[model samples]
Target: MIESTAPLLSVRDLTVAFDTQNGTRQVLHGISFDVMAGETVAIVGESGSGKSTAATSIIKLLAGTGRITGGSITLDGEELTHLSEREMERVRGRAIGYVPQDPMSNLNPVWSIGFQVEEAVRANGLAQGRAAVRARAIEVLQQAGLADAAKRLRQFPHQFSGGMRQRALIGIGLAADPRLLIADEPTSALDVTVQRVILDHMASLTRDRGTSMLLITHDLGLAAERAERLIVMQNGSIVESGPSKEILQNPQHPYTKRLVAAAPSVASQRIQAVVEDRGVETLEDLAAIPPTVRVAGLTKDYRIRQGGFRSEMFRAVDDVSFEIPRGKTLALVGESGSGKSTVAKMVLKLEDPTSGTIEIDGMDVSGFSRAQSFGLRRRMQPVFQDPYGSLDPLRNLENTIAEPLEIHGVGDRASRRERVRELLDQVSLPQDLATRYPSELSGGQRQRVAIARALALKPDIVVLDEAVSALDVLVQAQILKLLADLQTELGLTYLFITHDLAVVRVSSDLVCVMERGRIVEQGTVDETFANPKQEYTSRLLEAIPGASIPLGGL
Candidate 1:
C-alpha cells in the first residue's frame, strides 16, 4: 500500500464541461483522487464515464470545446490549474507524459517513428544535436519493448502493425522519463498476448524509474490485477474508490458490482466451467450436421516485389479450412497478420482464394459469376471491427441501415424505413436514434448500429470480423448476448474473427486457432480450450489478462 503522505499528484472537486451547440454541458462533477509517488492507480469505467476526460483535463489536453469548469490539480505541491498554455506545454513532456488511447489518431502518419520520438526528446531538452536525438530515440523505443528500434525507426506508422504502433507511442511518451505517466486505454487495440507484453513492460519500467502511472481502462479485471488502487467511474462521476482487490472482492457500489460481473475475463471462466461440467457435443457432432458454410483447403496469395524486377507470391491464408453449421459460430482466433481477417474476406467472397473451394449452403462460391457474386452478398454480410469506420459519417442511423436494403432492392422507401425501425429495435437501440449521426452515438451504440445494418438484408451468414473488440466489457456482453439471441431467432451462421480468447470462449461453439496463415488447431471450443495441442494455442490461452485470478473467488 502507498503511504498516505504528501502525494505526488492531487485533485479535488474536479468539474469539467464541453461547449456543445445546445450550450455548455457538464461531463464530470466534483471528482477527487490522488496518486502517490511510485504508485500505480487505475481509473476503470465504460465509455462516456469521464475517465479519459479527467485524465486529459489534468494535462490540459482536453479537446477544443472541453474545459475544466471547477477543479484543483496539484502536482508536487504546485498548482497546475493556473498554469499558462506555454508553461503547460513545457510541463507536458518534462513533468507529465501522456499515451493516448488510439495510436493512429495520436501518431502523425506522415512522419517516421524516429522523427516523432526525436521531436519529443529535443522538445523536452532530453537530448541535443541530431546524432544524440537519434540515439536517444532508439534507446527509448528499445526500452519500451520495441525490437530492432534503430532499424524500425525509419518506418512510417502505416508500416507498423497495431501493436508496433502502440509500442512506438509508448516509446514517445516515456522518452523524457516524466514523473507521471497517464496511459489511456493503451492496450485496448492489441491482442491479448501483445497487450500483456506491453503492459508488463510498462509496469516494470514505471516501477524501476519510480514514475507514477494513471491507467485509464474499461476492463475491471485488468485494473484489479495490475493496479494497487482502483477508481470506479460511471456516467461522468466516481462511484467508488479503494484498494483494487478489496473493491473486486466486495464491491460496495452497484455499478462496480455490475462492472465486475460483466468483465469478460471473469465471465469467460464461468463459461469454461459450465461447458466443462455439462459436456458439450464434440466437433464430430457438428460434422454430422449439414454445414451452412464450408471452406476446403482455402488459401490466398499476394504478389510482392522482391527486387527491381523480381516478385514473390506471399501466402496470406495457407491451407486454412473450417466449417460452420447452420446457426452456429466458428471463431478464427489469431494475432494481427495471422490470417484471421484474410480468411474472413475469403469466406465472404470479398477476396478470391488462390486455391480450394468455398461452398455456402451447397453452392460453390469460387465459381460465382459477377451477377452471382452480387446476389451472394445479400445472403452474406460483414460487420467490421471498427464501428466508426464501418458506419457512414454523413448517413444517419435510418439511412445507414436502409442503404443495404435499398442496394439489394428488398423493399420500397416505406418498407425499408419500417425495416430500419425493426432492426433498431432488434438491436435494442432507441427509436429516436434513427435521426442521430454516427458521431452522435457511443462506441457500443455505433456497434449496435453496425450490427443492425449487417442484418438489414436478412443475411444467412453474418461474418463478424472483430465486431465487439472495441467495446467496453459491459457493452461487449450485451452485444454478444444480442448476437446469440439473434442467431437463435434467425438461424444465422456467424464466421466470427477475433484475437480475444475470452470472447472465443463465450461466443463461439467451435474454435480455429490460426498462426502465421495456417490453422494449427481446430476443434469444439470445450475440447480446444481444455487441452490445446499446439504451443502457440497454449501461449494465447495463457496470455489472457487476469487469467491467474480466480473469478469464483472474486
Candidate 2:
C-alpha cells in the first residue's frame, strides 16, 4: 500500500508561467499533489495543460520561457523550488530522474550510448573506474530488457532502434539510482508489442526498487495500465485526483469523462467491430477495377558489417505485396525496424525499391523519371508523423500551407491564401494562427497545420504516418473524425501507417499487419480485428492496455 505519511514528493500551490509576447501566460495554476514511495502517479492532460512544465519544475529544468511563479516543490521533504542552479545540478540526476517524451532529441547524436550512460553516472559523483561503469551500464541496460545489452553498448544512437533507444534512455535515468523517476509520455512512439513490454518492465523495476514516479501522458489507457493513482489536468489546474481504478471507472470531471471516452481502445474495438460486415476477405477481391495503390515483389537491401570489415547484405523489406482501395485506409502496423517506415519511404518515392513494382491508379511508377515522379507527387500527398519536423521552423503557417500549391503552380497568391483558409477551417484551426511559425504552435495545432498543408493540393490520396499518435485522446478523436469527414467529402484515399491498433480501428477500412519485413495478416478492418489469424496480430491486439475497461459513464 502507498504510504499515507510524509510523501516522497510533495507539491503545494505549485504555479509556473511563461513570459510570451501575448503576455505572461500562467501554466500550472496552484496545483498540488503527493507522490508516495514505490507508487506510480500519472499527470494526465492535453496539449498546453502544463503536465510537462510541472515535471521539469521538480528538477529545475523548466525551459527558458517558463519560471516558477509561486508555491514550492519538495523532494523527500527538502525544498527544491529555491535551489540554486549549481546545487540543482547535483540533485537532478541523483534525486530526480527525467525521461522526456522524445529520446532521440534528449540523447546526444554524436556520443556512443554507453558513453552517455556513463557520463550520467559520473554526474552523480559515481566516478568509478571505466570498467566498473561499463559493467553497471550493461547491468542497467539488461534490467531495461534491451537485447544483447553488452554488445549494443558499442552501438551508436542510430544503430539502436526506437524502442531500444527508449530503453537506453531509461537505463541512463536509472544509472544513478534516482529516488524519483519522471517519464513524460514514455510509450508515445512505440508499437503495441514493444510499448507493453517496456511499460511492464518499468512498472516492475520501479516497484522492486521502491522508486516513486510521476508519469506525464495523454493516453488514458496507458495511465490505467501503469499508474496506481491519476491526476487529471486541464488548461493548467488539477480537475480530478483519485486512484487509477476510480478514475477509469468513475471519472468525476467532464474533461476526464471526455478523455476516457475519446480513447479509441483496442479492447473496446475488439468487443464491437467498427464495420458492420466483413466486405473484403482477400486483397485480390477487394474492389472492382484495381487497388488504389499496389506493391508486388518489393525488396530493399542494406549493407551491414560484423567484427572485421567483412560486410553482408541485410534485407529490410523482402518481397512484400499489399493493396489499398480507393477512398479507404490501409494501416501498415509494426514495431520499429519492422520495415514499416521503409515501405512508406518506398511508397512516397523517397527511397528506390531494389526490386519491385509500385502501381498507383494502375500506373507503374517503377521507372518514373523526374517529370513522371512529380506528376505522381501531385496526385499524392504525405502527412508525416512528426509535424514539427515536417514543417519549416523559419516559415510561418501561411507559407507552410501554401508550399504545395506554390510548387504545383495551382493558384495565384490570393487564391492560394483563400485555399489555405479553407484548409485551415477544415482542420478546425483558427485563421489567426496562419501567421505563426511551427515553433509557436502546440503539438495539436501543428498537426492540424500539417493536415492543412497536406490538403492544400487536394490530392487523391494522403499518407497519414502516425498522424494522430502524438496527440491527446480528445485531439486524436477530433483528428480522426476530421480524416473521416475529409474522406467522405473529397473521396480521398489514405494509407495510414501506424503501430497503434486503436488508430487502425478508428481510421482504417482495411488492415495489414507487418512483422520483421513481412505482411503477416491482411483483410478488412472487421475481418482481421474480429478474428486475428496471425499470432503477431493477436499479440498486438492483446498488448493494448485497458482494452477491456469501459469508459466511465459521462
Candidate 3:
C-alpha cells in the first residue's frame, strides 16, 4: 500500500467559481492537493464544501457557468487546464475514469448494462468487433465484483438492484484501463453493509490494477476508513490534511471536530426519553397499555416471471412483528432487499401484505371499508426518503403541503393556507418558501418541506423510510433534531426505516433487525446496539465506516 514518491496527480492553488443569476460565486478558494502513484486520496466535507466542485473542475466538467478560475492541474506531468473539449474527452475515459455519485442518473436507463460497458470499451478502441467488446464488458463487470455478469448482459439499469447498478457504473468507468479513477460519493446511496462490500471490492480492484483514486465524499468517517490520506474542506478551503488515522483520531479544525462529533458514531444518546409517569415504563408493560401502531405476522409475496410463463413466488416480508408505543420511535434496520421497506410499505398501505394484521390505535385494518381506509390514511402519513421526488414538482410549497388537507376535505382554502404556514413554522422552514418550488430549494430545505407536508394532516403515526440517509451529517443532524422536536410536540409515533445503525442507536427507542425476509433481532436500541445478539447485527455495526476509530474524546 506504499505509494511512490512521485505524484501521479498534482493540483496547485486551484480555484472554482459558478455564475449564478445574481453574480459569479467563487466556491473553491485556491485549494491544493496531490495523489501519489498507486495511492488513494479522499477529500471529505459536508455538501457545498467544494469536494465535488474541485473534482469536477479537474476534468473541466463544471456545470452551469462553473469554471476553474485559478490554478493548475497536472496529471502525469501533463497540464490539463489548457485542454480543449475534444482533448479532454480523450483523457476522460482512457486516462482518467470517473464514477459519479448516482448510478441511476449516470447510467442510461434505455440501454442494457452490457451495451454501456461495450460502448466505453469500443470507444477506447479496447476491442474492434462487437463480440470482443462484449467479452471485455463481462470481464470489466466481473472486475467490479458483479457475479453472473454474462447472464445479466441484457438487463437494463432499472432491472438491476442498487448494488448491481453501481457495479455496472464501476464497470463502465474502469473498462478503458484508466491510470486514475475519481469516484464521487460512489457508494453514499447504498446501505452500510452494501457500502462496505462495494468499497472493499473497489479498493481491491484499484490496488490490483495499480490505479490511483481521488474519492470525493461528505463522510469523514468513511474517508478515514477508505483512504490512506485525507483532506478536510470547509467553506471552500482545506482546513486540515494528513494521514487518515492521525486526523481521524484527533480532528484539529472546529468544522472537522463538528463532523466527527455529528457523525452517528459519536452522537446524542436518544431522540426523546420517556417520562417516568408517561409512555411505556418497560417492555413488559407493552401488553398492559394499548400500542399506537401494531404489526403482526406481516408477510408479502411477489410472483416473478423467469423468461417464459414460468413464475416463482418470492417472499419479500415474512412473519415480521413489531410495535411502536404512542410518541415512541421504532427503527426498522436491514441491508438492501431485507424486507424493512416492504414492512414499512405494508404499514403505510402502499403494498398489501399476503398475510398479516395491522392495527392503528387498536383498530384493525384487515377488513376496513373504503371510508375506513380513507380515514386510516388520514391518521397515518409517510415522509419518504427522496424529499424532492416525493413532492410534486409543478406545485408550490403551499399547494404541495395543502394537497393532503384538500384531498381529505379538512379545511377551506384560507384555513388550509394558514395551516400550511403553521406546519412550515413547526418544521423550522420560513414562510416565504411557500411560493417557491422544489427545484429552487436545497436538499435540507426540500426535506423540511416534505416534513411540513407530512404533518399537514396531523397524523398520529409517521412512517419515515430512510428519511435522513441521503443528507449530509450536519443537515441530517438538523433533521433528526427536528423529528425529535416534532415527535415531542405532536405526540407522534414513528416507524423509522434505515440502514444506518448509528442513527438507529440515537433516534429510536426500539430496534428491529431484519435479514432477507425475517426479523432476526428486536430490542431496545441501547441494549441491542451495545450487545448485538445476532452475528448479522454485529457485522452491520462493524461495517459502519470508521467504526474501529475510538470516539471517546469527541
Candidate 4:
C-alpha cells in the first residue's frame, strides 16, 4: 500500500497535559508517529492510556482542561501547532475529517440527519444552493451505505438504529472528502452485524477514495483487521509500533501481549463451568436439582396506539424458552431490540408473561405469593449493563457491596462489615478500598464491586444483562475470567445477555440467538459457532471483527 517513503502526517515529541484542581497532569508522554499516505494506521489501548487524547491533540479539539503542552503536529509539511483557531477550523473538515466515538451524543437531537449533513457540507463550502446541498447530502449518505438516503434524510437521530446513526456520522465525515479520516471507536456501541456492515462500507469508501485513516480503538482484534500498521499506547507512551501482523503474532510489550490475548478468538478460551470443590460449596447436589431456572413458551406483549381510541398489541418477547443449568452460563445473544433484555426481565419476575411458565428449581413462579417472591429474590440476583449507572455514586465500595445484605436483613452490622471485607477479597479488590467511593475506583473496580454485591446473598443464579458490553477489551477479559472463577468456587448459575457473538464464544457454555423477539438458534457454543444453523447466527459470527484473521495458532 505504501507508494512512497514520504508520510502524509507526522508528529514529533507530542506531549499533552490537563489542568485540574490538583495540578497539571501530563497525559501523552512525548509520543511520536507517522501516518503514511493512503495508509490505514491504528493506535490502540485501554481507557486512560491516552489513545484518544493523542488523536484529539492532532485536531486541537481536546475537551475541557486538555491542552497540548508540547508537540509538533503537521499536515503535508504545514505546521499546525502555531495555527490560530480560525486556521485550525479551516483545516478541520476540508483537510482532516473526524468521526467521533459516540454518535448519539455527537449528533444533535432536534436536527434532522440531512440538516447535520448539510451543515457539514455547507460549512466546508463543498456545494452551493439549497438544492445542490440536498443532493450532496444524499450522495454522501449513500456513500456511507445508507439505503433510501433521500427518504431517511428527514429522520432524526433517535429514529435511526445504532448502525444507521454511525453511517450518518460517517457520511458527515466523508462529506468533504478530506485527505485523512480519523475514526475514533466508530463501531464500539453497535451490534456485531451492524459493526461489520459499517466497517465494510467505511473500508470500501476510504480505499476507493484513497483516503488515509487513523483508526483508534481499545480492541486489538479490530485494529489488526482494519489497519496495516499498529501503534500500541500504554500509560500515555508508545510501547510498540510495527506492522499489524508483527504486532499481533509477536508482541513484545506485556500490555500489547495482554491486548492480543484479550482479542476474542473463534477457537479459544472455551466456555466451560469450572467446578472447584472448596469443601464448603458442594456441586454434587446441584445435578439432582432440576435446572436452576426453566422457561416454556415465554412471551411478553405491549400496546401501541394507532389513532383515536384504538390500540394494537406488540409482542416484545415471543415464545422464548430456555433452561440454565446449575453453575453454567447461558448467554442470550442478539442485537438491540432483540427481546433479550425483555426475556431477562420476565425471568426476574419483573413482568408478567402473557402465556408461559417460568420455573425455578422445578417450582413455577406464576402463583408465587409475596413471601415466596421475597425468598426468590434471595435465590436470584441481577448485575445490570452500565455499572456506573447501576451503582450508587454516593456509596462507598464497602457499603455498596453490603447494601444488598442490609436490604435483605441477612446479617447484623458487625457481620455485614466482615462480609463486605470477604466480598472485597473475593472480587480481588484491595482491603483499603472499603473507604473509597465509586468515583475513586476505575470502571473495572466498580463492576467488580457490583458483582460482589450480587454475590453478597450467595444467590443460586445471577442474571447479567449486557454486563461486560460497556467495558474495554482487556478489562472485559479480566471480568469474564473473574466470573468464571467465582462460578467455580461459588457454583453460581449465570444468565449472560449480550449483543456480541464473539463474547458469547468465550463466556457461555450454551448459546441462544435472538432476533426480532424470537429465538432463532440454540445449542452449545462450539457446535453452534462451528456451524450456525440460522442466517442471523451466521451473520453474527461472521461479523465478529477480525473473524478472518488467523489468531488461533498464535
- For candidate 2, write residues 1-554 as lDDT tens digits: 85458899999999999999989988889999999888899999888888888888888888989999999899888999888999899888787888888888888999988888778766777668888888877887888888788888888898888889999888877767789999998878888888888888888888888889899998888888788899999888999999997898998888888888788876444212133575444545565535789989999998888768899999999888988887777889887778888988889998899999999988899899988999888888899888878999999999999999999989899999999999888988989988989998888788889988988888898988888877878888888888887887788888888988877886777887888898888887877888999998889888887776666744
Model 3 regions lying over 4 Å from their true place:
1-4, 266-268, 273-282, 285-289
Name the candidate that leads on lDDT. Answer: 1
For residues 1-554, write the lDDT of model 4, one tens digit per residue. Answer: 74578788999999999999999999999999999888999999998899999888999999999999897998988999899999998989889999999999999999999999999999999899999999999999999989999999999999999899999999888888888999999999888888878888889988998999999998777888899999999999999999997788888888888888887767665534454443321233333445888889998999989789999999999998888887788899998889999999888888888889999989999778778888899989999988889999998888899898888998899999999999999989998999899889888988999999999998989999989887898888889989988888888899999998778888887788999999999877777888889998888888787777765224
Q: Please list the residue runs of candidate 2 whose C-alpha ends up more than 4 Å from where it truly belongs after superposition.
A: 1-4, 21-23, 267-290, 305-309
Give each model's whole-structure lDDT.
Answer: 0.89, 0.85, 0.88, 0.88
Per-residue C-alpha lDDT of model 3 across residues 1-554, encoded as one tens digit per residue: 96458789999999988888999899999999999888999998888888998888888888889988899999999999999999999999899999999999989999988888888898888898878888988898998888999988898999999988998888888888789999999999998988999999889889988999999998877988889999999889999999988887888888888887777772347755344445434566544556899899999999999977799999999999988888788999999999999999889887878999999878889667778888888889999999878989999999999999999999899999999999989999889989999999989999999888889999989999999999999889899989988998898889999999888877888889999999999987777877889999999999998877765227
Q: TM-scores, in order shown? A: 0.95, 0.92, 0.95, 0.93
| lDDT per residue (tens digit) for residues 1-554 in model 1 | 95558889999999999999999999999999999999999999998899999999999989889999898999998899999999898889789999999999888999998899999889989888899989999998999888898999999999898889998888888888899999999999899889988999999989889999999999776887789999999988999999988888788888888887787761363232122354567888888989999899998999999879999989999998888999788999998889999999888888899999999988889989989999999999999999989999999999999998888888799999999999999999989999999998988999999999999999999999999989998899899988988887788898999999988888889899999999999999888888999999999988887767654323
User: The CA-based lDDT of model 3 is what?
Assistant: 0.88
TM-score of 3: 0.95
Clashing pairs in 2: none
Instruction: Please give the clash total of every predicted structure, in order.
Output: 0, 0, 0, 0
Evaluate model 2: give its lDDT: 0.85
Question: What's the best-to-worst order under TM-score?
Answer: 1, 3, 4, 2
Runs in model 1 deviating more than 4 A are 1-4, 266-279, 552-554
Model 1: pairs clashing at backbone N, Cα or C within 3 Å: none
TM-score of 4: 0.93
